[model samples]
Target chain A: MSILLHDDTRVIVQGITGKIGSVQTKWMLQYGTKIVGGVTPGKGGQVVEGLPVFNYVEDAVKETGANASVFFVPAAFVLDAFFETIDAGIDFIVIVPEHIPVHDVMKMRDYADEKGITALGPTTPGILVPGKGKMGIMPASLFAPGRVGIISRSGTLSYEFAGILSEKQIGQSTVVGMGADPVVLCNLPKILAMFENDPDTDAVIIVGEVGGEQEEKAAEFIAGHMKKPVAAYIAGRFSPQGKKMGHAGAIVRGSAGTYEGKTGALREAGVTVLESPIHVHAWAEKYRLR
Target chain B: MRLHEYEGMDIFEKFGIPVPERGVAGTVDETLNIAEKTGYPAILKSQVLVGGRGLAGGIRPVQTPEECRTTAEALLETEIKGLPVREIMVCKKAVIERELYLGITIDGYSGRPVVVVSTEGGVHIEETARTSPDKIASFKIDPKFGFYPYQAVALLRRAGLDGKPLNACADILVRLYKVFRQYEAMIAEINPLAVLADGGLMAVDAVLEIDDSAMFRVKKMLSLSPEGRIGNRLERKGKEIGVTYVDLDGDIGLISSGAGLGMASMDIIGHGMEPANFLETGGGITADLLYKCMDLILMKPLRAVFINIYGGINPIHEGAKGIVRYIKDHGVTLPIVAKALGNHQEETWEILKSGGIHVVTEAATEKAVERLAALLNTSSPMSRS
Candidate 1:
């Protein structure tokens, strides 16, 4: 009953031969993700963590019926890998690398849109469906099966929130790290729509940060469409303007991407916006979301 | 990665987009030489990265060699927004019949490159876009097919351009699109694409910001303006080590695993206590690399250091080891507050405690910040030997 990923969502790892890919593949496997195969150019027929490797995604797709992909490819090769995955008819993809060229990200996002595929991130930790399946690099111990669907723009912050939720015995349904890139494929609104429809998700937690209008737009969508209770925690409230605070997307340009703007919008949307990550548990308890 | 006007014009010239003959000058002699070459009625533009150069009087239209000398001297001495004017761009002033705007930038919402054209040009485009949105015409370019001629023509025509101006604007737009694509630019703008009195089109002002991530692909373009790499010593050192470190006006040295986490840490360290710098060690960094990052953060005068790590790809133990090694080797006596979560958290806690470091066990950053603030309030500032 997860939002994007489930137990039978057969996944394949792209760039599985690389150091990060191999490590994450093992971690994803350990988290009970149904990793079917892997793809690494010139490394076909190789085995990584007992999964078969193919030179191309098409081969992996054809042989294993892998409908999802997790790209651990370098930033330079992300576009090519993305195109290949799209062409192979993979429905979902998680791009793990950060600092992907904005142009390439745009193209990948546009192509993914045209093809109707769910491409997650260029700098994301991917998605986690607690006690079921995980497709990202998030620590598995921090999650538990619950009714709250969590969506965030950060990996570490997602882990932090999940840890808080786990500590409070407030489990989650699915957690999606939309990546902190300025141009991400699955924005807050799109993921919110999915969360709104999921019956297993009684409430949703949005971990938003400064920069970009995604949070504002998400608030707009929630105000109009959302029926379930939602809580939010935004980072970078005290971050200085103009200076990019690590994330490519987390910059306060003029008044467009400020914490106040985002928080105001979310509060107006009937969402309980928490002042800190630890307060999410208390807020969730107050809301009485089972 | 934002190119100066002179550098932007260089790229425009390479793409055959019409630009007024221009030369960059660092000295009064160089300014005089370029002024002579470009002839009288030249424009002296200070080449600083920040905007509002025109409002700051960094741009001066000089009529004579004497005026050029005085203006260039004054501009070179001036500082716009705290950034000194290191160089001035001297160019032949174009006769403007009409000023138009043409720019290619990524639309954050659509996740696509967009070409924005406006007949109401030269003034604050942001203001125009905010207030009079209908004054400008925007065309989203599909990156797969790129900016087509028909799309450019349609946008230009919609912006009240017709006949010669329309075709000329279309040509420049296409050429600008090429430059945008070729250089992998985040923003390629000709704020005032001036149409001269004689129906000639020229880029009066140019701004091109290349995507910093695409630097590896455009080494030659970067090498052309190596001196443009402007930052402090810590930033430069961070760049060298494949990390991001931005100096701030605070006393608490901070380090975190992810960019979002780093920024969130900075935000949580509230109550008038600013973070000294923003440091993201990134994922899967080794203990040695973390030690180097600690060394950079420790270089600054700090009352306390807050190390927050939520290990996903980056193991908490590695960060703990790095901090332990740094403390043991450097004998850093500054009051330090650390919070480690995720993989190997127990071991990481044990290592830091064994190294005689007090670790903040609060999982929430807000509580951790409160703990750090309380610790700092109780202990006097350490005297650096």
Candidate 2:
């Protein structure tokens, strides 16, 4: 079974009337996701893609028993929308939009932690579960059904990694975007823990990059607790120091967040480290994971 | 965005954190007036965001009006670490009994605010963390309740501090933490938080960097600079165009839909050509944004252009039209290569190829880079790094 999402993971789209929200809602539905309904304050009694919309999150949850949410609210209102989801007891949340102020995210993380709710991203690429359903804006066609569980810090790299594997006929069970922001709610170690408990996943792939010590922590956790084989590919290998390359979080500050450090840590933890994302099939072949 | 030294002091004074007597000036006449008000032996420091100001001839101690004029004029006109100085700060120099370092910043790993204190002040914090790790002490703040009273004391006590000196520094740390939280700053630092001869502590130098993402709400809380944060002109233009662009010392102009792909486009080892800049369109792309993106990338020195994009949430076909429009408008003849896929894939390829842009429809980014290397007529061993 999938870790956070499964056959019964009912999700409600927040800000369903917006351009991005409506477009992604259509895509998610087409991808076989179990999107129950939607929420918007003013346009309560509307329908988007045949899904009923309600005024508030609680109303939507009351009507459809929606336990998960994916938001495409504008940057300014994300704080209120996120708090509403947390208050409505949404078990899972995936925030898709970028440029939400970091302080608002910090407060969201704190409240979500207090309630023990799982929130994926403020700038995440969203999560995809092949052959079951999907949430967020990941191109569902690029993935295949397999036994590999993948987690990544960058959305585009994860797509490349999964696309390469799909080309090689190696499918994935669940591919999670860890959110590209510097301060994400879920760290590598925590998502690894979730992947470990997922019965559908046989092996886990840690797709990381230069910028922060999340990889080091994941390496430590993998060496100590994980039983399934782990493979990793850290991006930004030749990225210059102190310059923000991709994500706000993907920077090498001083001596802490470097490509060498992340790769070294994972290798030290007995993880099969690939030189690049295109070499993902090599890891799958070496482990006979396909 | 990193705040200038005078701006940091303005924030510090508002928080009741003691700072040196000073005022910011934009011209030599204003500089002389402020320096005269501070009497002899004044400090003239350039107001810049970049580091290494101390050794860049941007900071000097002047004792006479003539010295102040010359130093202030030179600093106002000069660039520190390639960042132009627009203002100068004149402060009444202090007699320091000792120097200490104290700062609060969000730690990368913990995703929590951290407080760091060191006895070694007047030195770059990075150098201190690298060369003398033992001399510095840091602790993460509890996300729920924030810094406890004893944590600040613990930080200073590790630096052989005791009694009055310890209490004073700890008090400053608490105020600094408050300012850090209130402003939503990424970095709030007081280098050489000087313990003066009169048994008082003042922030001799200050650094406060607010997270640019928070400016939407934070602009209401604090009075920001009227012009806002000063940045590289092209970087500022990139922000206005709703993309992230980083100018680099390379020969190839590169653009991608995501940060990961942009860096990958540059890191291909066998290509042997360096990327001139890094630009990420970040999922949301409009024809206008794409048209403007071409204009921005062309501002840099480049031998060729390489683009890697995957459209998940982006309307990439519309973006292709913008690229074609830009090519026609500017009459650009540089060899350009693109690997764009997902969503309306065939339409995107048609538009790009019609513009005489070499297009690779493969999922692998290496294929695009290899195509670029061949187009550049380079036969060096080509492979992904």
Runs in model 1 lying further than 4 Å from the true structure: A243-256, B161-164, B378-385
CAPRI verdict (incorrect, acceptable, medium, high) for model 2: acceptable
What is the fnat of model 2 with respect to the true interface contacts?
Answer: 0.39
lDDT of 1 at A227: 99
- The residue-by-residue lDDT of candidate 1 on B100-165, one tens digit each, is 888887768778777888887775666666566566787877777767778899988886778788
Candidate 2, residues B1-385: lDDT per residue as tens digits? 7777887898888888899789889899999999889877999988777666786778899989999998888887787766787888899878899888887777756667777777877755556666776767777787678775587898788866776778878888999998888888888888879988988999988888788888776778666555425557888889888898877888888889988777666677325778888899997798888999999999976799988888788888999999999999999899999888777878999999999999986677776777888888775343333
Q: Can you tell me which runs of candidate 2 are displaced by over 4 Å?
A: A243-254, B148-150, B221-229, B269-271, B379-385
Write down the RMSD of candidate 2 (Cα, Å).
2.7
Compute the lDDT of residue A146 as modeled in candidate 1.
90
Cα lDDT computed for each candidate against the true fold: 0.83, 0.82
Q: What CAPRI-style quality would you assign to candidate 1? A: acceptable
